[model samples]
Target: MTSRVRLGSLIAMLAVAASGCSTELPGSAIAAEPSATPAISDARSGEVFGDLKACDLLEPTTTPKGFAAPEIERYESDNGCAAQKRGYASVSIYLVPEAGIDQLSPGQGTKIPTKVGGREAVEIPGDSGTEACTVAIAVTPNARMTASTSLNEGTNEEACALARELAVAAEPKLPRVG
Candidate 1:
C-alpha cells in the first residue's frame, strides 16, 4: 500500500509538471502575422549615381595654381578617380553609393565640419608627419563624394584648402540631393 501511494504521488507530480510544458515545434509560429518592421534595401535610401564615373566630373585642364595639368586615372573596380600632379600634389575623388558624410572614417586627423557649394561637408586635416587632407561632401542621406589631397611640400591647412576646392568644383556635377 505504501509503494502504491508513492507511485501515485510521483505520477501526480509529473502530471502537474507536464501541464506547464508546451507542445509547439521549433519553427512553428505562435500567430500567422506580418512583421512590424519593413525590410531595407538600396532603393529605399534615395537616388544614386548610376554609371556616372568620377573622372568625368572634373576637367584635366582646370587645376589649382602651381600644380601641373591633372593626369586623370579612373579606378578599375570602384567609382573613383585620381587627378595627380607629379611631384607636387594629387587629388583623388570617390563616389560612395551607400555611405554619407556622417559615415566617413576620419582616419588619424582632426575632423572639421564645413560646407562645399552649400552642401554639408567635413574636412579632416592630416595628422602629424603627414601632408594630406580629405573633404567629404554629402550627396544624399546614404551617399557621399570625397576629395582627398596630398601635397608634398604643403601644410595641413593648404592641403585642406585644396581638398575643399576640389570638392567644390566637383559638387555641381554630382546628383542633387534633397
Candidate 2:
C-alpha cells in the first residue's frame, strides 16, 4: 500500500510538470516581429552621422539681457569630423554618416595664418562670441543613435554629456548640405 501511494504521488507530480511545458499558453503563439521599428532610429534625431548627412550653420540666437552668448560655430560632418581654424580657437565636428549624429569639439581660438604673422595669437574664453563655439553630433552604427556636445566654460563635462544626450533625443534626420 505505501509503495502504491508513493508511485501515485510521483505520477501526479510528473503530469503537472508536463502540463506546464505544454504549448497551450498564448505566449507560444506570438512571434517576434523583426519589422518593428526601434524608437531610437536615425530619423528621430538631428543626427548628422547616419541618415542625416549634414547641418547648416544657422545664426546664433541672442542670449539674455544680462548674460552673453558663448561663441558658437555651426559645423557639419560627412565621413568624419572636420577641423577649422578660427582666430586662436579650432572647431571640429564628427559624423558617423550611418547613425546620423554629430560630435562637436571647440579648441582654443587662435589667430589666422597671415603674411607678417608677428602678432601673438589670442585664446578666446569659452564664454566669448557665439561663433567661437563648435558643436558636433555623433551617430553610432546600426543603433542609429545621435548625440551632440558644446564647449563652453559654463557647460560642465556632465552638461556636455547631457547635451549629447539631448542631441540624440532631437528629431527626424536629414542630410548635410552646406
Candidate 3:
C-alpha cells in the first residue's frame, strides 16, 4: 500500500473510533461502561434544590415588609413552582443550566446588573412594571437560579426591588454545588 493511502486509512480509523463508530477496537480491550446510572439532563436542578421545593425559596423571614406573603403554586408539566404576593409582586424560580448572565438589550425592558446573596445576577424588569419582575442569579457555573416576578401592587421599580430581595433570600438556599 502507498504510504499516503496507509496514512489516510489510519486517519479515517481514528476518526471513526473517536466517534464511537466501532463498538470495539482491534487488539484493544474496550473500557467497560460506567456502572452508575447516567445523570438526567436537568439533574442539576434537583441537586441544587435537593428535597427543597420552589416555594421553599420564598423566605418570609427574609422577605421585606412591603411585599405581602406569597401564594405558592407548583406545576407538574415542567416541574416548576411559583410564589406570588397579591397585588404587590409574584416571583417564580426555575433551573436554567449555564444560562447567560448578561441580558441587557433593547425592548427586553431595562436590565440592570446586580447581586443576590452576594452572587452575580441580572434584574430583568417585568411587564406592567408595577406587577412583574424576573431576577436571574448565577448560582453556579452550570446552574442559574431564575426568579421572575409580576408586580400588581406597586410600581415597576418596587417590583424589581422586591424581586432582588426575593432572589437574595433564595440564593443562599440553593446548594453551592457545581
Provide the overall lDDT of each model, using Cα atoms, as 2-decimal numbers. Answer: 0.75, 0.33, 0.61
Candidate 2: where is the Cα deviation over 4 Å?
1-51, 56-94, 98-146, 155-158, 161-170, 174-178
What are the clashing pairs of model 3?
Answer: 87-152, 87-153, 129-156, 130-151, 131-150, 131-151, 131-152, 132-150, 132-151, 133-149
Models 1 onward score TM values of 0.65, 0.24, 0.56
Name the runs in model 1 displaced over 4 angstroms: 1-47, 60-77, 127-129
Given candidate 1, what's the lDDT at residue 129? 38
Task: Give per-residue CA lDDT, model 3, range 63-161, as digits (tens).
Answer: 555445444555321334565455444566665543345432313466677777778877777543445677777755555666666756666677677
Per-residue lDDT tens digits for candidate 2, residues 1-178, read: 9999999999999999988795455645668777554444444344333343322211111121122323333333232222222322222323434432112223443222211122111122232334332223322332222223333433334433433333333322423222
- What does each candidate score in C-alpha RMSD? 16.0, 19.4, 12.3
Give me the overall lDDT of model 1.
0.75
The candidate that wins on TM-score is 1
Residue 62 in candidate 3, Cα distance off native in Å: 8.9
Cand. 2 Cα-lDDT: 0.33
lDDT score, candidate 3: 0.61
Model 1 Cα shift for residue 131 (angstroms)? 1.1
